[model samples]
Target: MTDLNARHAIVTGGGSGIGLAIARSLAGAGADVTITGRTLSRLEEAAAGDPRLHPLAMDVTDESSVADGIAGAVAARGPMAICVANAGVAEGRNLLKTDLTFWRHIMATNLDGAFLTIRESLRSMAALDYGRVIAVSSIAGVRGLKGAPAYSASKHGVIGLIRALSEDFLGKPVTFNAICPAYVDTDIVTRNVNAIRDRAGVTDEEALQMMVSQNRHKRLIDASEVGAAALWLCDPASGSVNGQTIEIAGGQAA
Candidate 1:
């Protein structure tokens, strides 16, 4: 049996991309997973006929939605032993051209949403005293991504939250950590590629290369790589690995 046998987990944004991959990994490891997103159809699609993967429609940006959605998941699957706050928006805009609405939108989904998810999940996790809180930050969180001031700042804020929570929960059974990934081949990246192509008047290949070149490996990362990192963070022996940012940018020096 896997370490996650009979464990209950909640993965936000699990309708697609990295979130879905992580949910699959957790379920494969014997977890009873609740996959959440804003679209019920997408969430149901991700469930993919898997009995262990339950679909929950949730908008992380809405406090009431987060609260009720998590409550319902816990009521059905029991207390969430693992919470992966992976719901976020990835967009780039120069500081000069960015507006308050743009900045707040990113923060609402990336930073504030993560804070809400972690906060609500902890209400149940604290009772069990055993939990793993993983936030899907970006390499931008560590350093900074060019042309994306708002995104970088929001990601940095996520890492800050994780660090603070880790300190607050010192020596406790719960651990808080953030995974900083570079350009992974997800739908988000595809959208960014299109945006870049349109903005820069560059070819599709060139736009993709622009992102791929940022990684040390000069290749797009896989969602499973991030999922595996998350899995490692939840390992029984990883109790002492807290408050750290694990960068999966193909060995990028961050």
Candidate 2:
């Protein structure tokens, strides 16, 4: 296990699913992990009395909230050495039915949220000698997913943001990367299964299969699998693995 004692890390949307998995992995490695979400109760429940996992209420779509929330976390736990921008909303809508409100909502929570989280974390990370910025992107980011134009575009934007930041801080100690996973077994999938059932007029099991079939292995990925990948990226030996999109898609993504 990589020792991260005394290090401070922040994970947005850490109340559940992939974010919580990543937070647990970091905390297990001895890092002081702060988990943020819009719901305080959910965050606290997820923390489950773990002293290392601190729960914080933060609305990522709001810039002031993100800035102030991150500033307070830094103030309490020292500089942020690891930042995981994992907060996101996943919904699929046909282009003809997609309203501007829906599109902007996705962009706000996915693209803009990652931008704000990374920007605020960088304020302290840039001053330090070692830092890691990890954004949770999706397989849709690398390829277009039918019926989800807005979501796909927003995730693509996240990859672009991370890649550009990697270039901007080239030769610096801080490294930026995005984790792209395919159909992870999370609450997001369960909700989307219901949505798919309604949208496609299929049984719940059939709708779930629709997603399971998308992965090359024909199975839903475990959240812990993605968590392990993130921990690897934060390892001391991963300093050279910057500006990359790691696809945990069970096999060749293409």
Candidate 3:
């Protein structure tokens, strides 16, 4: 509902999935959007034909990359009033199968990446009196998933960070929040389906059904649904809604 004609927004992993939907949604709302990912080709494809979309190749896990990428974007466009830390990978391995390498990879991408993005975004955002920072966490952050200890931990860290930051900036013009969605129909779900099939020795249909069954509505959530939530969080009316996790689960799981 906010007119974002002059606002500049940054969405990581905007090449595909929920990130792409959020990018398009923000741009459609009149904001100039900068979409970043590791792949230049995909970012280009996502931005093509949309003047409001600017593509920047960024690897969020690297401090230098995030610093330079955001700097270039702010220089070319303007200060970032909205920052969405949406780049992440979802995978599950039981404690028995989980090693330091696997656990570190998840934490680096899901948790550390978000930290770097938010920190860098604040530099540009400080110039403005108001800003919004939203992290894309998961239902796992609310409750532990059956087999994804590391993924769940990473999401938990995200919500914890948002909560603490909100209080740290209380009474300021900036706000921090997170979204915890259940079973979104992103490419991540398809990959998770395949993993479930292989691990449980079940048919693809059965594997998919397992995920669907977890949703109270017994259906996969659309990516655009999450996008709409992101748009709402960045809206001017949402300034008072900081430190909250807006769960997109079909029912009250918490």
Candidate 4:
């Protein structure tokens, strides 16, 4: 629908969840998409015989892995026109209980991973006349989430990086933006439900309800909803919508 034919895109952490959804959306729009994750089998399975979707094994937390993986994608598909930095880990720990290791791990995956992915994609995108860079942040980035200081800080850093890069590339064809969503119904949410159940000593249903209530709409967001937002940003009409954070928090103002 967006007429992304002849375009090449890359989505990091695309084995499942939000990243996979975005990758599928881009591919459905006719872009040749490379989906990367640490698990080759999972990435391949996610590709699921789709000719438009290519799978690559990559570890975002490792600098060399990101650099090489992106390079490989470029070599295979050509210059990247759309880059989605969506690979992230979500975990909540009380500030007093968070150690340096925990903090660094969150930063490395969520913040550093985004930085490296964007930087690598920009290398080839700069030579092209048109490009779009989208980072998957969280509502927590806009406002600090309770008991997840490190995760919140990392997501906030992602938005900061996107905004700064948008400024740096003003007047250029490349546009940078961030997508912030709240309590999406994904595997992450499922895992978080279990964690909360254990930590809060609540039933799984109640724990899930906690997340659902966090969204302004009082329901879990469908992953496809976020995918649609990403697709809209990549549309030709969205060229002017640069350097903005599009919140999919069910009416929550970001």
Could you tally the backbone clashes for each prediction? 0, 0, 0, 0
Top candidate on lDDT is 2
Q: What TM-score should be assigned to candidate 1?
A: 0.98
Model 1 stretches with alpha carbons more than 4 Å out: none
* Residue-wise C-alpha lDDT for candidate 1, range 71-181, written one tens digit per residue: 998898899899999999999999999999999999999999999999999999998857999999999999999999999999999999999999999988999999999
* TM-score, every prediction: 0.98, 0.99, 0.98, 0.99
For model 2 the local lDDT of residue 157 reads 99
- lDDT (Cα, 0-100) at 161 in candidate 2: 99
lDDT minimum window of 10 residues, candidate 3: 1-10
The digit string of per-residue lDDT tens for model 4 on 1-254 reads 69899999999988899998899999999999999988999998999889999999999999999999999899988999999999999999999999999999999999999999999999999999999999999999998899999999999999999999999999999899999999898999999989999999999999999989889989899999999999999998899999999999998653
Clashing pairs in 2: none
Screening candidate 1 with a backbone cut-off below 3 angstroms (N, C-alpha, C), the clashing residue pairs are: none
lDDT of candidate 2 over 166-194, digit per residue (tens): 99999999899999999999998999988
lDDT of 3 by residue, 57-97 (tens): 99999999999999999999989999999999999999999
Sort the candidates on lDDT, descending order: 2, 4, 3, 1
Alpha-carbon RMSD of each model: 1.0, 0.7, 0.8, 0.8
lDDT of 4 at 214: 88
